[model samples]
Target: MRYAVALAVAMAGLQAMPAQGAGQRETGLEETLAQRCDAAAASPFDRDRPSGVPGVPSHEIDPAIAIPACMAAVRAAPEVPRLWYQLARADLAARRFDEFRDMAARAEALGHAGGAHALGQSHEAGHHGARDLAAARRLYEKAADAGFAPAMVDLGVMLEDGTGGTADVAAANAWYLKAAEAGEVAAMNLLGDNLVAGNGIGRDAALGARWYRRAADKGDGFAMASLGLLLELGNGVPRNMKEANAWYRKSAVAGNRRGMRLLALNLETGNGLERDPRGAVSWYKRAIEAGDVMSMRLISFSYFNGTGVPKDPQEGLYWLRKAAEAGDPAAMVTLGLRYTAGSNVPLDFERGLGWLRKAAEQGEPRAEAALAVLGDAPPGRSACRSVLGDYHALDARYGALPARFSGTLPAFRAVCAGFPGLKEDDVRRCHLLNPDGAGDFVRRVRKQCR
Candidate 1:
């Protein structure tokens, strides 16, 4: 939400004329930086290509080499804001806060868009002082208005998050669209997010897919993962788990945490790739190291099932508690079950019920079910105990145990007989077994036409 995106968006200042010899012959800081850029281009280890290219960089100069040359160039042309901008970049690379701040501010005062953007980055990051959202916004606005695409995206993020002012999702989306049109790849991904979520716009999955494609084509990792999710779910495209897995792998290689989690899931489930529990565990651990709580929950499941690592219910319980404590409602309900059933932990009714209540407060459906069934029941109600057992057993059959699954209400009435006011299809109830000794189908769905 900080209106300070990557500083690599500019270094040698805005495209200063062309990279030709005639343009470089002019005596100014731009020429000096231009020449330095050419030197960098000649090096196999360095690059300066910007926009819509994979495995390329935007302003990939050796800050160390550019530092001394930029310092001298600034000395020669103190009035040229671009020279001061380059000096500021060098100062930033060297961690020279006082000089960086001073030069960046001076360049901004002298009408340099990149300088304004640089100062915004510093303010947003609290590099030279305390974080200043207000200053960051003002500087970013100026730079964005001056046609800095990165600043436009940063400003949009701040507007959407309401960090610097009141949240205006519509305005935020507008800025994202602007930046996306201007070829800011990150903005393309963000614009897709806005479209999909209907944040300041009507929810349009096709439009979201379009923008995601644009960014993903540019090899943006976030866009790749997002598009993969859409493809996997058939949200705005066909369900193609194979293609989804490919994108997930690409995004993971690009270091996207969500990509790592998704790839781990595919590996765990053998959905589009060969099942590799150890590989799944490895990716989950990587995602956890990057602070993904969702991965923590999945990793707990691996431990519990002995799918990736050795089966260790104790370690599973440990991770479940950690995930629950970290605010995963599903894990919270699972933890509550652990305490309630004492299957993996001690049965402490009060504590277990308390955990369930907390999870229910967060709108976890399984927690609500637990409360409805056992809120007031102690260990001695034989009917309630039997019903709860049947409920869980059905879920286990359907592979969603501890998670709510649908059931036919008439079947429930036939089993729990005289249950009041229940007369509809139920996605909330578990499947019931036939009371008949023959074990034939009862109220379960018989066939699928499609």
Candidate 2:
């Protein structure tokens, strides 16, 4: 009996030794799979690794390769938070927002701060779902508390803007300072903006310039453009047109639309460099291609005056319409006025009013006032209506002035008296309704009607 028991024990020990060896091999394979996923999907902005070491940009990651590798890694080590986070990043790169959200939630549950921040961003941006600002703010707060620099910066923006809750400028500044101290470039830019604007903080222009320079030195294009602005205007730094233009060129090369536009403006006006209308037009076109609506307007003006290109009113009109179509309220207002005045296009009251109504709906005070004036005029009074619309368009191009007192005063009153139901006092007041007075003017009109 003793021999039989010993033989059974020896067999069990031999079997356990092989099982241990198999377990070690499986562990090594799982690690290799996880590493493959990490290589494919890790973010350049990830704070998990050592500071200042950039990994792959999310856009550069090939989803086809990343997704399969990450899936295998996640399957191999389901309990590893880092693997789950990497898988989430892969899904996000593929624009599989729903899957990314789920995977990010899993990684966040497993205590990955990057996963929490990414999840918060998804909620904030309303990716593949409704925006849940409260949920986003909560997630950002959690990750920020965990010492995540990106989360700290995002949370600061939310608090300052009151996106998910009441505005807390002090708290927002605190978070920005924290992230900035931790070497977050975006936070540095925000800090610079706040200091320059003195928004809920004491003015510190010199300090703001320093903050902008710090981030600009780190290859942040937005900061480079901002610092350039300060230098150009001599706001916080000594006026240095050469340095400012150099920074603007650097920022433009780095793909900043504002930088491109600014560089174009400088070339056109000879502000910081010799006037080069052709170069200005080229830069403006580049900015337009980069999705800058304002550049569209500027380029349209260039085409209208033959500044660099040949005089082409039709091309100018086309660009104006493009800007208006892209939802630029200023462009809509300009196009609406031009249509009313028959400046570029044939006189079309309906089309003009339609454009003005769109701009008014977006809270453009100029559009609202123009609409009010035209609305009171009878359809039969086309000549009177044209004069009113033309004067307003001129005001929009230049700046607003008192309607009863401007160059159009004689015609303005004559038209006011011609309208059957229109009150001259109300018409004049409409012209006075600048952006700051728009709300009060609306309230008074509403009260009068009541």
- Give the clashing residue pairs of candidate 1, or none: 406-427
Which residue runs of candidate 1 sit more than 4 Å off their true CA positions? 1-30, 37-69, 87-100, 127-130, 349-375, 381-450
Q: Score candidate 2 by lDDT.
A: 0.77
Query: Candidate 2 on 1-450: residue-level lDDT in tens?
Result: 432354355435434543446779678767666677778887655666434435566667877777777777787789888778787888888788988899999989999988998899889989866899999999999999998888999999999999998899889988998999888898999999999999777889899999999999998889998999899888889999999999999999999888998889789768779999899999989999899887887787678768889989899899989989999777788788778767678978779889999999999876877777676666555555554554454344323113423544343444444543335564555555333233554343333222
Which sections of candidate 2 miss by over 4 Å? 1-23, 44-47, 50-54, 126-129, 349-450
* Candidate of highest TM-score: 2
Q: Please list the C-alpha lDDT of all candidates, in the order they appear.
A: 0.68, 0.77
Per-prediction TM-score to the true structure, in the order listed: 0.72, 0.75
